[model samples]
Target: MPRRVFVHIGAPKTGSTYVQNVLFDNAERLEKAGILIPATFAAHDQAMTDLREVPWRDPEAYWTWDLLAEKAAAFRGDVILTSEGFGAASAEQAKRAVESLQPAEVHVVVAARDLWRTFPSMWQQSIRARGTWRFEDFLAAVEKGEFEGFWEHYTANRMFLRWGDLVPPAQRHLVTVPPPGVSHDLLWQRFAGVFGIPDGLCEMTEPTANPSLGAPEIELLRRVNAALGDRYPHRMPYQRVVQQHLVKAVLQKRANNVRFGVGLDRADWVMALAEEQINQLRAYDCHIVGDLDELRPAVMTDSHSPGELADRQLLDAAVETIVGMIGHADELRQMIPPGHSGVLARVRRGIRRRLG
Candidate 1:
């Protein structure tokens, strides 16, 4: 049986992807040191999706949770399972997970960042996930408890409280993301510490960052999603074509000089709430790896509202979108196998392009 199980429950926008990439990159080295990161994170992702009862494209998600737990319980060395979806786990789901991985000393690690910083990134991510809400409207929904995902996954205090109920305080860990403008290497160091990974063992050579959009870029995406409406209602198609190809592989590579931020005037209540939450977390019995103050959001001197994007900014964003879509389309064209399937696929794409 595994001696220890480290669960990295992600509070998103907190450098989770970077950490996962490092782990995936160094899987062989970590395995040689008696630590096993499963060959695939797909099972873990499906498991979380099933646990949350969220709508996804995978039918196999319903049972992957149990399968992954079984794999972890049966392993002989230390194991690390990571997924941001675990942050949304209910008390019941947490309990079920704990019971399934019996005999292994389970520890939960929650990676977090300032709510102010995370909120904008979270809203932007939602847009990528096919959400059609404007930035201001998204903030309103968050304030009204309409966005339970924000509270459940992004709030540090709430996450520790829920997971603490399943595991002892000694087994609960917190890793605060370093302040912006600092090296991201520091964040990776703190995360690796939770698994007893020695320094210099994991090298970060790949550019695996999932970059966020500037105000104008996200604003344009919101408008596009609103226009598309139910035309592309399915998640898988939208994820592959829009989110991965257009957003990740194309749009993020564009040179945009604008930054997105929250105004102090609009963030007064949020700041107060964050301070109060951090105070409570300090009192809670858990292991903290980085400075707690880092969790306090830095106030912005100027905030850019997506509603006020300049005409030039809008034109640049539009032109970039067109260029990115054309590039992504060609890239996809090259991916199809050269045969009957390729010919039919090209014909369908040609008809769509001509019709548009």
Candidate 2:
């Protein structure tokens, strides 16, 4: 039976991808040390989706948590399962998660970020997930209970409310994301500590970071999303077409000087939320890997917001993005295999076959 389990429930954009990448990069080394990180657990993270009972494109997501728990029950070593999805698991979902990982000592780790920082990234993330809300409106909605589900991910207090009963105070960990411009190595070190990974076991080497958009680019995409509502209604097509193709190929290549931020007026509220979270978490006395003050957002003094973008700037960016998409189409017209079943197409076919 597994002796230990560490579940890294992420509040997104806190360098979770980089952590997962490092795990895969040194899987063998980690396994030899009596720590088992299954490739499925690290790469797909479908288990969280299963636990939360959320909809996703993966056919295998339905039973992924049970499958991993089964694997964990059979293993003799410690296991680490990570997913940002778990950060938003409801109380019932969290109970189910605890029950499934039976007999093993389960620990919860939430690498949470400041709302000021995480909210913007999450707005862009919502757009990437085919949401059509403007940044301002998204902020307003999330501030209220209207989109509390999204808000729950970044709030450790709410997360703890759901999962705190499942584990002892010592087993619950709050790994605060270091402030902007701090070395990510520090973040990795914190994660390694919570995972019981020893320092210098593997060459930290270079890091893999997911490319993210600036405020203007994200605003442009938001406008584009509103204009093209429901054309790619499902997750996979929207992901392949907008998220993968247009955003990665076109927008990410452009030089974006605008930074996303909360206004100076809003900074006080952001800090208050941080204070509330820190106070709530302190009562739990959870093992903290980094300073809780780091969760207090540093208000930007010279931010260039998406709303401040000029009409000409947006027009030029849109034109350039269209040109890039055209070039990608040309490349596909030249290079794609005749019977190429793209991933979404294959999934659609599979779903139809299942229905048939």
What is the total number of backbone clashes in candidate 1?
0
Candidate 1 residue spans exceeding 4 A from truth:
60-63, 144-146, 310-312, 331-342, 345-356
Q: What is each predicted model's overall lDDT from 0 to 1?
A: 0.80, 0.78
Q: What's each prediction's TM-score?
A: 0.89, 0.88
How do the residues 264-297 of candidate 1 rate in per-residue lDDT, one tens digit apiece?
Answer: 6667867776788789889989999998888787
Tens digit of per-residue lDDT, candidate 2, span 1-356 = 88898887877778888788788788799999999887654344667766776665455334477887787678798988888778788888888888788779999888778777787787778887777777777667767758876757766777877886689988998888888888879999999998899999866747653467777688789788888955987666787788788888788877766676666766767677778877777777689889888877765553545767889878887888899899988877678677664865888899999999
| Most accurate candidate by TM-score | 1
Q: After superposition, how far is residue 298 of candidate 1 from its true place, in Å?
A: 3.3
Off by over 4 Å in 2: 41-44, 57-63, 144-146, 302-305, 333-356
Best lDDT goes to which candidate? Answer: 1
